[model samples]
Structure formats: C-alpha cells, structure tokens
Target: MASATVDSGGIGRASLFLASGTIVSRILGFVKLIVLAGMIGAYGDSADAFSIANQLPNTVYVIVAGGILTAVLVPQIVRASQHADGGTAYINKLLTLALLILTITTVVAVALAPLITGFIGLNLSSDQLALAIAFAYWCLPQMFFYGLYTLLGEVLNARKSFGPFTWVPVLNNVVAIAGLVVFAIMFGADPTGSRSAGEVTPAMVAVLAGSATLGVVAQALVLFYFWRRIGLRFRPDFHFRGVGLRATGRMAGWTFGMLLLTTGAGIAETQVATLATGQASVFVLATAWLIFMLPHSVITVSVATAYFTRMSEHAALAKFDLVKTDASSAIRGTTLLIVLASAVIAVCAYPFAAVFVSPFDQIVGIGNVILAFIVGLVPFCVLFVLQRTFYALGDTRTPFFFTLFQVVLILLGVLGCTQLPVEWIAVGIAGVITVSGVLQAALAAVLLRRRLGGLDGRRMLQSLVKYLTAAILPVLLGLSLVWLLGGTQQGGFAVSGRFGAIVSMIAVGLVMASSYFGMLLLMRSAELQAFLTPLRARLRR
Candidate 1:
C-alpha cells in the first residue's frame, strides 16, 4: 500500500490535535472518577466489585485481541491499502473476522460472567461476588463494542484521520458521567458498602453497567460518520481465505504472547491487592493507575501515535535514518514532558489524590499509592514510545521477549510484597509497576539501540539528566509551599471543601510548574524550546 501522506507540519500538529482531545477526555474522565468515588467510596466492597467486573471485559479483550488490534492492525491495514481495491477487500474481511470473534467471545464471556467475576474478586465477600456477577452480566458485552471501536479507530489512524479516534472517548466519558449522576441521585451515596446484594435491583444493575456499555457502543458507532468522511465504506466480506490476514495472523501470535505476559502481571497485581483488608483493594490500585496514565495518554500516546505511521512508512521504504530520527525525537520529547509531569504529580500527590477520595484516611491511602507510581512515570513513557517503534518496524517478537522478562520481574516484585499490611498492599503494587517499568525501559532501549544501529543515547541521556535536575528545585519548593499551606505528610491538606482543594492544587501547581519550566528555560534546553515553538508561533499570530 502507498504510504499515507505525512502532514507537512509534521508530528507537531498531529500531536496537538491528539493531545488536545486527550486533555479534554482525561479531564472528563477524572470528573467521572470523582463522581464514581462519591457514589461509591474507592475502597469499599461495592467499588471493588464494580471495578473488577467492569474491567473484566477489557482484560478479556486484551487477552484475546487488544494487542493485535493495536500492534498489528495499522501496519497490516497500511499494507492492505496498497492492494488493487485500495485494501477494501482485506479490510472488510478483517473487520468481518474481528466482529465474528468479538461476538463469539462476548457471548461466551457473558455466559461465564459469574465465574470470571468470582476469580477477579476472590477476596470479596459472597455478597460482593454476587453483585459483581450481576454487574458482569451487563458489562461483559462491552468486549464487542471495545473491539469495534478499536477496529474503526485504527482504520482511521491508517488513513491519517486521527482526531476522531482520540476524541470519541470524550463521548464515552460523558455518558458514563451522566449515568453516575443518575445513579447517585437514585441511590444516594453508597460509599460505605452498607448495601447488600439483595438491595441492588436489576434496574440498578442496568443503569450502572448498562450505561457504561452504552457509552462504549456510542463511542464505536460515532466513528462511522468519520469513516464515511474518509471515503471508506464497510462491507462485510465473509471470503477471508485470500486477504493478507495470514501475515497478520502470524504477527498476532507474538503480539498475543506479549499481551498474555502483560495481562498476567496485571492479574497478579490485582490478586495481590485483593488480599488486602484496608484501602488497598484492586479499585484503589486501578484509580492510582488512572492517575498514572493521565500524562502518558496525553503526551506519550499522542506523540507516539502521530509518529507511528510515518515511522512505519519510513521503515517500509527502508529509510532507517528517518525512522531513527523520529524515534529519538519522540523519546526525548515524551521523556521531558513526562518527567516534568511526574515531578509535579509527586509534589502534589496528596492533594491530587484527595480529589478522588473523601475522608482523610482514604486520601492518604490513595496519595501514597500515587507517589509510588510516580517513580515509574518517566520509564513507562519512554518504554511506550520505544515499543511503538518496534511495532512500526514489524518486530513484535523483541517486545514480547522483553515484556516476558518484565512480567517475570513484576511477579517476583508482587510476590515479595505479599507480607505487607493491607493498607500498604497498594503501595506494593505501585512499587512492582515502577520496578517493571524501569526494567522494561532499560531492555527496550538496549534492543532499540541494536535495531537502529545506535539511538543517540548520549544526547537522550543528557536531556533526561537536565530535565531531572531542573525538576528537583521546583518539586522541593512545591513541597515546601504545600507544607506551609497546611498540607500534611499523610496526604491530606487543610481545605474547606472540594473547591478549596482545587484552588490549592491549581495555585501550587502553577507555581511549581512555572519553576520547573523556568529552570528549563534558564538551562537553555533545546527540547523545551522545540516544545514551545508551536505555541510561540500560534501566539505570535
């Protein structure tokens, strides 16, 4: 297939659109989290049950198709597009195959929802297990929708129509938030886990899990308009024997293996968290993960997605130098932003976490977890871009091997944490994630260097050091400011209300962020200037 035309403005503009969409989506997503936390406290049985059940579909989907759809689909679609029919036959057949798989998988999953829920919530009370099973009946069907959304979105991505894929999640979040609002109004706050399984009506289950699934369906279907605008029409093609699917199937073997390893680590982490008795359940760990992914989704993912297709095209054309350049720029840019973000988050971890959990104790619990997770933020972001580089080069096996190693490390780390107190279990999980990220990043860097002949390591490391150094003073100053403003070491701050907490976070955040950027400017950081150039140009206009 002919390569999709690269935007002349390069990754900057593409990243901007993706980043903007992600910013809005993340903001709304956080709002949804806050509402859900209010409706059901983060650590309670209901919260854990609902979280595990709701996430089960995603887990199953990833185990089955997520990695392939993400790591293998774009390049396959790009190759298929070179066909005489503009890849239409291949795409239709692939889509048909995906839909068939999703339908079958969803049905089987929904039927086994109770057993799945039981496994995920092994540590939950029988009532919690039953509630989770009920929720699963409504939520498990989301697997099909999730697959649909990914298929549509990746096709758009291959066509270089990126905005819809990034922005559609906003609709999902909005619908979910609306449902949460209604659930809160109807049931009031159920944060105490006081409601038994008998009290949760079928209508309640439909409202909660059904509404969530509705959001996924809407997110998937809304892409059809964009699909039409791109001049692509979907036609079901059942004759899949001769399309390029054989190659994709070959690639998917390794991709699926990689996901299995990653998912195994996730399950291990969840199980370990479940053993906890206090505020360290899987829900709490998941919330912290949400927070950890905020900067990543907005920055690392945006830049990586923007560059992936171009890089793939370059690799396809044997332009190894261009591929190297793109990978280097993305890594450096993502590292700088994520490092800064990690510093800011670490300093404000307490108040930031306080936004999601009410009551002082829960605040401290989630806050500590956030801090622990922050340690891995930079490594995780770096590894994200590097993995995409591998995907673009059509080398899924390397990542699989590296990830298998990382998962081994993660399992070891989590097992070692089994002796910690319940409240500290979340911290242990965070630690495991951080350790795995570091190891994964290191190994990915090594492999990427070999693949590219060399990856400008000296330059990248220099930037990393400078950024880390620049972040230190700002973080210390922010901590001091927070301390002076009645923030406790335990993650709570003196605030009149949520509004007060927001005010404090913004005020402190601005001052800290300014300090970080100011230092970067003073140090004459080239990457910082490159980052600011687009904004500067827009402002000059």
Candidate 2:
C-alpha cells in the first residue's frame, strides 16, 4: 500500500465529498438567484437594494471568516489535537470565545444597520437607500448566524468532517428557495425587475429578508448534529487562561487586519459599482460574482480545502517538503480544471446569464461581467492554494501583506472605473478585481517560493502550459457553438429563454469537455489520469 504521505486517495475522496456538496449548493444557489430575479427582477431598484442588504451579511461573514475559519482555526486545532485531553478543552474555549464575539458583533451590526447601509450604498437615492437600510435591518442579523456556521463548520473541518461543512449549505439554499416560492405566491413575481424601491412593502421586507435569515439560522444550527456524530460536545467555557488561545488570537489578529483591508477594498468596489445603480451596477455585479464563484467554489475550493488540513498537519511537524508537494499538487490540479472552466464559461457567458435574467440587455450585462471576472479565475485559484499554504505553515503576517497589496490595487482600479460609462461600471469593477487577483497570486507565489525554497515551479509551469495548450481547441469549439446558436444576438436560441439557454449551455459544455478531455488524453497528462484513476478503481472494485 502507498504510504499515507503519498496517499492521494484520501485527499481525492475528501475532494470528491467537498466538490459534490459544492456542486449541489451552487446549483441551488443559482436556483435561488433565478427565484430572486423572478421576484424582484435583476437590475431593478428593489433588486439592487435587497442585493446590497443581503450582501452585507456575507461581507461581515467574510470578515469573520478571514481570520478564524481560514487562518487561525485549523492550524491551531491540528496542533491542539495532540494534547492529552484530545483538544476538547481547547475546542470548548475556542468555541465559547468565537460565539461570544459573534453575538456581540451581530448585535452591533444590527444596531448600526443604517450606518452600514449608508456607507455601502453611499450614492444611492433616498428611496433606494431607505429600502436598503430597511432590508439591512432585517438582513444584517445574519452576520451572527453566518459566523456561527463558520465557527462550528471550521471546527468540524479541523476534525476532518468536511461533508457537513459543504453539504449544509444545500439545506440553507433549499429553505431559502422555499421561502422565495411562498413569497412569490403571496406577493407575486417581478422577474423583469419592474418593482422600484418605493414600491416595496413591509410585509415583503419581512418575508424576503426574514426567510433569508432563517436559512442562515438553519444552516448554522444543523452543524451540531454532525458535531455530535463526530463525538464532540460543546460547553460554555469562560476560563480562557491557558488553552493556547493567546497564540490563536495572535494569528487571528493578523488575519483580521488582512481581511479588514480586503473588506475595505470590497466596500470601495461596492461604492464605485453603486455609481451606476440603475444601469446594471450593484445587483448585476452581485449576480455576476455568484456566477464567477461557482466553478471556483466547486473545483478550486474543494481541492484546496481538502489539502488544507493535510498541510496543516504536515506543517505542524515542520515537514516542508510534504507541504510543498501538496501545494503544487493542489495548484496544478485546480488550474487544469479552472482553465477549462474559465474558457468554456466565458464562451457561454450570455447563455448562462440568460438562465437567470430574461432581458437582452441584462443578459449582455451579466455576460460581460462574467467575461471580466472569469479572466482571473485561474489566478484566483492559484492564490487560494498559495494563501492556504502560508496559513498551513502558521504564517498569517505574510498573507496580510500580499492581501494588502491586492486591496490597494483594487481600490485604485475601482476609482478609475468611475470614469467609465454607467453600463460598463460593473464590468470595469470586475476587470479590476481580476487584474488585482492575477497580480496578488504572482506576489504570493514569489513569497511562498522564497519561504519554501522552491514550489516545483518548473513542473508546474510545464503543466500549466500543457493545460493552456490543450484548452485552445475546446475554447474555439465553444465559441463556434455559441455563434451557431447566436448566443450574443437577442431572441437567438441560446439567449431566447431560460429553457433554450440551459440546453445551449449544456450542449456547448459537453462539446468543450469532450474536446478538452481528448486533448489531455492524447498528451497522457498525469492530472487527467489522476482525476480518472480513482473512478476507474471504484468501478473495478
């Protein structure tokens, strides 16, 4: 049997679990968008208002997530696991502290909803700003529950319960979708975004934002079940003296600072995007971002997440070679798929956008944003791996500098975007972010290389070149199929309706995958065989 160090099988299985869950979650997420767009319409005042409000919690969650879930929790927990008491004492203390912070943060966020709304939606009209504040009052409470989910989920992830972390989001989406259906039944649909901020009623606010919060509550609470199954119990431990939490705090402090910089940049992006609020700005950017995240979430995140725990373990033991090996493997594996995904998705951008919104201009709006965002997809994944590699090595300060570097770039680029046409503002914001991501990833890789002594650069470059070469034909084929279906033309089959868009996207995706796979097969790519090898083994068994 292969040594556990070389046991790609375990990571592959974990990746499969993470990917499968992410795939379902993202699909439901798209469905939720479809329902949301149907109810409020994309690019409408109400949609942008709600989008701004809803995104507030996510922004807050990302802030909380930047430190604990991403940087501090796993490495610390992996270290604590070797304690004589099995780390229960550390877990209890950490959980108690995280929840306390979350509760305080949530209350404060809810109280300052108006202030938060004003800041994020600085340039909105009074009516729209008022609507966003109203929704934020209801929606910002999700900040606590979102933190709750991450706090618990990260603990589970530290314990290697990866499934529930990714799977529970499906429940969140399902509950939210059910709420959308009932909301539509009660209030009627507005898929064309005909409703303006002034037209929204209190009852509408209660149901829509309320249900969204409820979904987050459910998502956070359900993790306790998995927590129990894994034989972990939680108690409120307040004696925070000596369980090694000081070090955790030190790690989280740097991560928090880094994420604050990132959040500032996000705030800048939102403020800039809001300049063209009525013309595919805020809501369009939100929608386009969700589309852009699907492939990253499913492939890059799944693979990177699986590798993270392993890296943490190896790093705790000062095993840099294994960490280097895992990092390279993760980067190469994710890049291979991301390259293909980026190419195909960019080609099918219009059709994919058509599935969410019907208006030709809106489809084009979202499609253009997709193209802008997807250009950075490969680097985005690379950064994901590189950052985690740093975190795995228990170094948060370095990641902060690189993140700060990107944030500065983003802020400057977003300011420049304000001079562009209103219709192009969202696309410009996305393009700026993509460019910043590419630059950040490069800086991170260089930093990581200096620290790790090397990152298998020569082989990684060769594989990257190979993957790009292989994707050329598939990209051309996807573009041709898009043209054949007239994806860019209004009322064409690919953009005519939701049904046609789905069919066209599916057909085009299959053709592209086949061509890409054929190319890889001819080259005998290790990445391709590694993907197939597990499935082939399962079949034989």
Candidate 3:
C-alpha cells in the first residue's frame, strides 16, 4: 500500500493540482454549455426536458449512494489501510457491494423511467413530457456509471491520488461537446425548444443520450488504468460479511437521511420553477446554477477534498488540534477566492450571462438569476468546507441536522416563489438559495464551534471583513467599466455578434480580475499572499 502519511504542505499542493484540473475542466464545461445553449436555447422546452432528464439521474444517484461513497467510504478505507492486506479485501468487498446496489438501482430506475419523468416534468406540455421520458430512458442508466466513478474516485482519494478524479471529467465534457456539435450539424440549433416529439428521430436521441452515457462509461473505465499503475488490483469478492459493512451502514444511515432531505428540496425547487414559468424557467435556473458552481467546484471543492483526507487522518490519530488547524486553513483559503469571485460575478452578472444565452430577454432573465445567486456564493463555500470538516471527524449527523433546517427553509422559499410573477419566479428561486445559504452557513458555524470546542470565530470573521473590503474597489471598477463600455443595457453588452460579445466579456473580465488581485496585493492580505506563495516559488524555480 502507498504511504498514508502526507507531507506538511501536501494538502495545499494537492489542492493546487486539483484546482488546476478543475479550472481546465470548467473552461471545457463552459464551452460545452455554450455549445448546448446554441443547440437548445436557454429558455425552451427541449432545454428544459434535457436538463430535467439529466439532473434526475444525479438526484437519484445522490439519494442512493452519492453520500455514502463520498462521506463514508474514505474514512473507512483509511482505517482499513492499517490491515496486513493493505485494505485490498475491504476495498474489493466495498466495490462489489456498491456495484450490486448501483446495478439494481439503475435497472429499477430505468424500468420506472416514465413514472419518474412524469413526477419531475409534471408541469411540462404533452410534447415536452414525451421528450423528457424519451431522454430519461437513455439517461437513467447513468446512475450506474455515476456510482462506479464515485466509488473508484473515493478509493483514489483515500490513497492520496487526487488528479485522476479531477482530470477525468474533462473527457466527459469533451464527449458531450462532440455529440452536441454533431447534433447541431444534423438538426441545426433549436433555440426556441420548438422541436416536437414527432420531429425527433431515433438517431438524434441516440446521439444525444447515448453520447452522455458513453462519456460516463469512459470516465469510470479510465480509473482502472490508474488503479493498476498504483499496484492495486481489483478482484470480484462477494464476501460482504464481517468486512466493516456494519460501520459503513451506520455512517451511511445519517448521510442517506441528509440526501433524502436535500433531494426532496431540489425536487420541490424544480417543480416550482417548472410550474411557475414553464420549462424555460427551469433552464434559466439551471444555467445560473452552473455559473454559481464554477467557483465552488474549482476552489472550495478542491480545497475541501484535499484537506479531508488529512483531517480524517488527524482525527484517527486523536490529533484534534491538527484537524482544527487544517480546517481553519482550508476555510480561510476557500473564503478568500469565493468572496472575490462572488463580487466579480455579482457586478458583472449581466455581461457574463450575455455570453451564454442568446436574445436580449433570455439574457436579462439569466442575468437576474445570476445576480441573486452570486450573493450566496461565499456562504455556500463556507457551508461546503464545514460539512467536509464534520465528515472528516466521522460526524455526519450534525451536518445532516443543519442541512435539514436549510432544506426546510428552501421549501418555504420555493412556496413563496410560487406566488411571484411568472417573469420573476426564477429570480425568486435564486433569492431562496441565497437566503438558505446564509442561514446554513450561520448554523453550520455555530454547530461546528461546539463540535470543535471553538472554531476560531474571530479569525474567520476578520478574514471575511478584510476580503469584502478589498473586493469593494474591484467590484466598483468592474461595474463602472461595464456601464461605460456596454452602457446601461438590460440584457448584455449592446454588441452586434457573438464574436463581439465574446471579446467584450473577455476584456471586462480581465480588468475585473486584475483589479481585484491588485487590490488584494495592495491591502497586503495574508490570505492573498498565502495563496500566491507557491506560484512565486514555482516561478523562481
């Protein structure tokens, strides 16, 4: 087995590598989204149908094994590594059991695809519902591959091999992009989602859904090469008895509950969005969500994941102080980036959103949603790190309770959203997400303090204050530039063509980022310095 011990700065280095991969993957993902937007306009039935169908598998995957594989498996694998056989037996058994569960779930889900599609797309028109069901038939099978990818990735993470997991998603995006390109060439762009079920061909369905499933299959299969390189061999072992299944079950119990509440809230949100403003609203919300997740996936997830294994090891060794120290560093690091990102996103929401959606109206809709969602980004990052800290400590119950409270708030928010004007429903949902994020962050902070005996509250608050202060000038500068260059337009830069829009966004984004970092440097922010130290050293080398 590989050495379980990591170097003192290993988490930071690992986070950098993971962050780099995420940056590349996100760039590709953005291109893929752009391609998708061109193929199916941001607000339409087809876009909504595909988004709903695609998202359902992820929701089901989370409800079933996502939490277990993510929160429960790593710590167990870490514990099992101490055995004479290097946890091979434990790994094999766990893999076998997960595969069995995933296979069964996928079969059942596919068989019930129509029923599931009806529930998710209950507000859709007959044509939209039929298309969604057709997509679900192909997309539902992705649950198995999603499970396989997570199971393999978690094992890699437990062994301190993080790159393969982060980098592999690029392939998934590439495959999807290629498929979309082909579809565009064949069927042309369907910006209005006006394509009827009768017009849809089997070849189109195969290219669309088949390519998606193929990408996941490739993602899961690529890990085997890495597993071999690391000297780990997979063997089919069904001896699930007395192999730590009980402990995993116990951990998974709380996690499953948490997932249930979270997925319930998501379903409610989707239903509200769809019911309030048709399928277009769902697509708008999804587009905004993808942008919202960019910073979280690149910075927060990378930092939290890199720190988690180390934190778990510290907990195992009873080094509570070290765990606290790691958590503090991760929180500070993540907050620094997310705060800045949130500011930039909020200030430049319209122009940035204009890059994705065509037509002035759709751009305005998406931009409004983006602005509302951006306010929650920092708090959302905080919640993410705190949850991982709890998971690292082998305490999933506390996070679940806090999450349940957040979900209840979200459901109430969704209900309130249903009362809004059709045009504003997406914005209302975004507001709900923002409010819930703040509440969740506050609750998680208080609970985590009790769990950790004190979470350095003064330091965290100071960091938040300093980062926000530094961000103010950059945000103002970005907004002023947008106003001067793009005018007070509602949708996007009053640019003529796609090329012009792309150029305008790039220029505006560069100025914002440069000014933001410059302000941080001028403020002599310790977090900024810490973040840049490795880059400086690499330059010197």
Q: Tens digit of lDDT per residue, candidate 2, span 1-541? A: 0111113458887887788899999999999989898899887789989999999998887787535566889889999999999899999998898888888888888888899899999999999999999999989888888888888888888888888889899999999999999999999998887788898999999999999999999999998888888899999999999999888888888898898999899999999988997787888898888988999999999999889999999999999999999999999999989999999899999999998888899899999999999999999999999999999999999999999999999999999999999999999999999999999999999999999999999989999999999999999999999999989898999999999999999999999999998999999999899889878988999
lDDT of 3 at 154: 90
Error in Å for residue 398 of model 3: 0.9
Q: Candidate 3: minimum summed lDDT over ten consecutive residues — where?
A: 487-496
Residue 283 shift from truth in candidate 1, angstroms: 1.2
How does residue 77 of candidate 2 score in lDDT?
92
Model 3 C-alpha lDDT versus the unseen true structure = 0.84
Which of the two candidates, 2 or 3, achieves a greater lDDT against the reference?
A: 2
Clashing pairs in 3: none
lDDT for model 2, please. Answer: 0.90
lDDT tens per residue, model 3, 399-476? 889989999999999999889888898899889989998999999999998988989889888988888888788778
- lDDT at position 316, candidate 3: 81
Instruction: Please list the residue runs of candidate 1 whose C-alpha ends up more than 4 Å from where it truly belongs after superposition.
Output: 1-8, 196-198, 489-496
lDDT of 3 at 277: 47
**Which has the greatest TM-score?**
2
Query: What's the TM-score of every candidate structure?
Result: 0.96, 0.98, 0.96
**Using lDDT as the measure, what is the rank order of every candidate, best first?**
2, 1, 3
lDDT of 1 at 488: 67
